[model samples]
Target: MKNNPHHPYHPIIYVRGFAATQSEIEAAVADPYMGFNIGSTKTRLAWTGQVKRFHFESPLVRLMGEHGYRDVFVDGNDLVAGDFADQPIPYQSIIVYRYYDEASNDFGSGETPPIEHFARGLNKLILRLQDKVCANKRNNVSPEDFRVHLVAHSMGGLVCRAFLQNKGLGTEKARAAVDKLFTYATPHNGIDMRIVRNVPGWLSFGDANNFNRERMANYLDLPKGDDVSIVKHFPPERVFNLIGTNSRDYSVLRGASSWAAGDASDGLVRIENATTHGPGADGRDVTSPRAFVHRSHSGHYGIVNSEEGYQNLTRFLFGKLRIDGILDIDNITFPAELDKYHEENRAVRASYQIESAVSVRKYPWQITRREIRENSAIFRTYDQLFPGQPGTKRPPDRSMSPHLFSVFLDPEKSCKASKSVSLLCDLKLLTPDYEVDGVLFLKRHYEGGVIYQRQILVEAIPDTNAAGGWRIKYGDQENNPGKATLVAESRPLGDGDPASGLVFSIPIQQKSRPGLHGALRVEVRPWS
Candidate 1:
């Protein structure tokens, strides 16, 4: 370890591919069944050396160090084969287990083994790792205990799901053992990579005795009448999948049908296949809540190395960020009285052009900015009526068209004025009727994307409903208080603009209870 006692334990264990025995590994490696079959042993060996170099050496080790984690031990995938005894274990450790054992032809399918088996084996090892740590505590090496956070890639997530779903661990035991589980491109529902000639047809192979697919089904022990479908039994809560894709083509499985069709694949797995879903998902659709990204269809294998893939992965793993909505801009803060660009791109007829431009661009600003024309209105709308003033009530049909505010990100802000800030809008947010419309620009002061609603968290001082302003009641306010005051505030200034851009226009909601003068203050901390 790096000698940092305060470092949060985030030991990452990387499980390599098929671990079928010596002859099997050799046969798979030599055989030309698929595009490139390295078998279990070699792949595990390769991953071992690779992990030591790329992950355990310079870049990855340095990155984790920056994140306040010590350099934990990294074991090869075959540590179960008496490898651990040969390798000297380090301080904090990460034990990677092989999904398929070479000595066992159990992993029937060419893909990774079924999750339940993987989980059973993994959990056994985890229990051992825990015991080892606990032993150290008793030996006077550590003062406190810590939990292990997992970071699995590809099918490893299935293993995590199996581990979590093993109710035998009990809710508390499961939660205590695994604090956070991160998977990169794991296909929770057996990804439909389109690699098979037809999905239903491939699923039919479940009946063919001696067929690889049949073996796989038997190994998993799906309801195949006395066969084993281990994964069918895992729990769902303790896993997080990191979906990745690239615009390149690394997976070239000849003879087999193209899995992605014309769409993108991360080489081996399709973007959709890399997702996770189960009972824990509740009722959300594949695209609801808008979390994962669909990048290039580079094939399944190399998606992790792509720029977009890496960015999304790291963001999901470390940064508590979310793209709530696109920022539509109604007013551009061009210098006062400065001549606005009146190019064909800026005219009212250019709406289609603007929309098209935003769709293809990742960075919102790539959409050219247009000069504002004198007396030119962006668009017109029927003035919608609101619930007229409380006391001076008007007819129910009263309506007014209010200017939409556009938000922006101003990286150059020196804390002088808000106008100098810019905004961050995604191309998807440019869609007119989306609920998150006008949310493109983010408030620079908060360091996170804006949302449409917020929950407030504060302790009320001199708690009085009549008071116009809220007084800060700091520490210990949860009980009795003589605490110092600390003010915490936030608000969901809905999309400020109608046109998409970095700087978004915010819409002001109806005022708080007619007589209440103070603004509604909201506060939130994003889930990272």
Candidate 2:
């Protein structure tokens, strides 16, 4: 009578991050939820040195409260360990893969097992969960319909990837059961320190070598010289990478970890290495959907325990619409003085930075943010953008265009019960200083100068009866605040199915010299 295996509200398996030391592992084993239940009560104001009491009831509690998801533990015993072969649990359950229990002295030999071992355990756990879930008589869920979403943090993401990618580590049935994956501050490219570059493969203390790229390659079944972020076995689009950009709040090891990890990190995982990319349907590498939040790696302000992280997680898991932004450049114009220098063939070079902050209409926090101040803005060199111009013979690479952000939106969460969803994108194209004849050309240069900056407000009205099933309108927020007046023409992608959604192009051009000429391509698609 009940929808047991809901379409989007699938069972969530929480895979906790790495525990560095023996004590840490013991502590991890002691916790029932493995840090997933941990919440925060205070937040620091970024602009002002003030602390605010913002109670975040953690992702675990929030899921149980907002959604009807229940934990597997019943009567002080996990359902997996109990005699529940015939007993059926709710389809929307939260299962914690307690892999660290094998390493804890209280449970096993007090010796940590390899990641492959954890991955194999996950496979077995999924099969067991499938058996139990399918046993429900009232629920109409078949073995093929039984799916689970993996919500992991830090190194746990790698474990999920291993279970999906490494054929020997998991069964095909278990791999197929995995519907979607959401990772928080995961170092898909392996952890790298400021001084050490990459974590040494020989550093086996507390299994630190697990973060090493070579070690990861072996366990993840990645070929030599391959990017560790590439996922070959699974659909990368279904994976959402939540990247943390605040490093100052990560006080792990008395701030030593943040120091070693350096800037542009979430105290532990570097921003550039946190997300992942994989081969697209056309055999080209495509980056997974990802967002940036100002949260630490793990602490009171950790990514997993924050509101921003939970919002993104819930939307990605149950959202109705997915929107992606990409900046496609047509051409860039230089000042007359710089053009004259280029005409002389004296070697002119300039690099640009693109900054963006994305947020929902009523949400206070930005879903994704990249700025020059945070050192997370998209950067491209003059040669990379305008190749074959002055110094090189190769043409401009359109593939080099920067992806701004990919955000999932739930139509149910539309502001004030409105039928449309409003997304605000504050974008900035910063100007680059020039170099003539390998010398600094600072004749009229100024620091922190932006060539083009505007806040673009996009309002998407989804109508089933519409031509493309959606009506999109956008406006420059700088000129017309809090409004989207310009109707966006629907350009359907791929087969032009309404489910595939449509693409809207917003022209971005600066008529003045030393400016940018580009189009902000917004792709809207139906997401489950």
Which candidate has the highest TM-score of all? 2
Residue ranges of candidate 2 with Cα displaced over 4 Å: 1-5, 43-52, 85-87, 391-396, 415-418, 496-498
RMSD of each: 15.8, 2.5
- TM-score for each of the candidates: 0.46, 0.95
Model 1: residue 381 alpha-carbon error in angstroms: 22
lDDT of each: 0.34, 0.87
- What lDDT tens digits, residue by residue, belong to model 2 across residues 1-528? 134448889989999999989999998989999999999897547546676667899999999999989998876878865686655687888999999998999999999999999999999999998888878765579887788899999999999999999999999999998989999999999999988888899998888888898889888899855368888789899999999888999998999999998889999999988988899788878789999888899998899999989989999999999889888887777789988888777788888988999989776788889987777899998788767756335455788888998989888878665488889999888889788888988887779888888889988987778767888889987789988899877777767676678898988878898777878899998887
Q: What is the lDDT of residue 187 in candidate 1?
A: 45
Write down the worst ten-residue block by lDDT for model 2: 387-396
lDDT of 1 by residue, 224-247 (tens): 432221232333223444443332
Q: Give the TM-score of candidate 2.
A: 0.95
Candidate 1 lDDT score at position 513: 18
